[model samples]
Target: MTPEEITRTSTTYNLQSWSKQKGLNPIPVKGGEGIYFWDHSGKKYADMSSQLVNLNLGHGNRAIIDAIKDQAEKYCYISPSYGSEPRAELAKMLVELMPDNIGKVFFTNAGADANENAIKMARMYTGRYKVFSRYRSYHGSTFGAGNLTGEPRRYPLEPGIPGFVKFFDPYIYREPIEFASEEAASAYYVAKLREQVCYEGSDKVAAIVMETITGSNGIIIPPKGYLEGVRKICDDYGIMMICDEVMAGFGRTGKMFGFQNWNIKPDLVSFAKGVTCGYVQLGGVAVSKKIAAFFDDNVLSCGLTYSGHPLACAAGIACVKYYTEHKVLDNVNKVGKTLGEILEAMKKKHECVGDVRYIGLFAAVELVKNRKTKEPLVPYGKDPDGVMKGLVGKLAQKGFMTYSHENMILVAPPLIITEEQLREEMKKLDEVLGEVKA
Candidate 1:
């Protein structure tokens, strides 16, 4: 179909997530290669958001493509009851990649299901009813995972499943109370969290779920010692620690996993996006050896028909090998530093840039109406002024594709992005933000 036909058919018959259907002008992407994708009109744009921050290896990776093809030719569908070479190989690879304590894997189609299963596993393993997650998080959109989410997206799914509790994130930049240092800020937040845990009854808590280095609702990196404090709290309360690494995993955060940035080990880890670099749908929860052993005697009580599908697993295995063989993590660390430097410079140059938080290739630039008051350019969940919307539109017009959430702009290109391409695309971002008024 032609680009116009595609757009018309989609707009008429399809419903979009997080947006009104009327007047929506969705981009008709025909093909993509590396860090660039072109529309049907042949207009090219750099994929700064990594197409929802999932395409870590970038578009059209031959290794992953060949793996999928090879798997399909051999055999595609197999029930979860049966053993499959690709599934076993991918699971083994994941166990090796994850923390030493996390020795088993349970596959799912994507992050939402991974999170849902993770929650279930936590509740069952601990025999506790409540779970805690931060206020500025997006776990997934499924029933259980959506309720675990702490942002406005959860509002529409209101009066959701019971036993999900909310907690405040340690956003130092926007902290209401002043602290002399990050250490102090970390202490304060951790102390308050401990109190909340006490009030909520520690023995009744199942787990503490968090996006290690929060994604989507601003890349709010936790303060130093903050994650360690939470880990200690979980240990003290016999509560499981769960890290949702869907967006921050697979070299997006310089490290292979976001939690690796700190000295801690979560009992359960939920990951999806970069497992196959969005080549095919594959996500899973990695459980500690202790939890895995519990299932050896008792039933897991969770299953998916598509769990560990051969094609997806084959793609995952290939993606993991590619990352290791090509040293993609090294590239992320090297180029990520340069990207951070460029963004830091932009923060100094642009008045609209209230704050810039970045680690590796994952980043967000917060826009503000006033730096003095730190007023957000677009208030949370309400961009009625359209300032942030217009800014993103201008960037797209300039052939630099990115997306904004609330008052922040995300700049997470593929992990394969080079220093030269990084500088070029970021220059475009700086130019676009430089044009915006304070």
Candidate 2:
């Protein structure tokens, strides 16, 4: 199709074709494979956002396509309440891949529902009403999950479901305890969290939820021992630990889950995005056996119609098989090292870059108006309607795609992206950053 045809279709059906922005639009993708897509205009753009940070396996994997087709032909849309072969098999495999004591899976068609369900599970397990999440974190967009979110994106969703409380993030660059030792910073934040819990009445707190590495929030990698400290606090307070691994799981972090980097285990790990590598829609809550057993004796009171859809199960099974056989996790680790070095070099060259953080294949560059003062390039989402909106466009015009949110740029390409490809993309990004100003 021509650009005019694509634009016409977009205009007729998608009134807000670009995520609620007045003039924003998207390229009409004809097809995708590996890490790039060709638009209706016959222009190719690297899918740097992984199409909402899914597509961990890239696109057009024959194995996933075949599995999806085969499953649809055999059986499709069997109610999730009924257990089918694919669903049962997928559950078994998921448990095997997860950490010890996490043996139950609750499926969903998307990330928001997964988190919402996970939150419900946490509350049910603890029989407490309050949840604690961070200011820089995003759980999901649904009312329940949005309330659990920390950023301004959740503002519209408020007054959010009651009992969810927010806290400051452990951003070392814009550190709350600046000039302090890393160990001291961790201890201080832990103490502050403890105080917050007490202020809220720890007994009334159901869970302490967090994005393992705070995705879409500048990739804030907390100081070491931070998660372990949280774990200990939860253990002491009898609060359930819920980690939203929606954007940080399934080989995206080289390990199976982002929390694994700290070697800390959460009571519930809500996941989506990379599970089926965006081959088919799938998301779910991976619960500890203790929490799973709670529902065994009592009603869980949470489920969705399309939970564990057969096609999604088939796709998930195939996706995991591909990751194991092709060693995608290993590739992420290998390429992650290279990407890490490149990003550090970028920070050195670009003073506007306040911080660089990465884990496995996931990475982000935080932009600042003044590096010494650590002032954000602009307030989040209040872009002031100028070249700020074109930062991403500038990268795109240079034949690369990157995701910009707030004042940070997500450099997360597909896990399958190579060092050479990353270098090329980074070069384009550097050129664009040089031209951008606060």
- Deviating ranges (above 4 Å) for candidate 1: none
TM-score of each: 0.99, 0.96
Worst 10 residues of 2 by lDDT: 17-26
TM-score of 1: 0.99
lDDT of 2 by residue, 108-142 (tens): 98888998898888888898999999999888888
**Top TM-score: which candidate number?**
1
RMSD of each: 0.8, 1.6
Q: Per model, state how many residue pairs clash.
A: 0, 0
Q: Model 2 Cα RMSD, Å?
A: 1.6
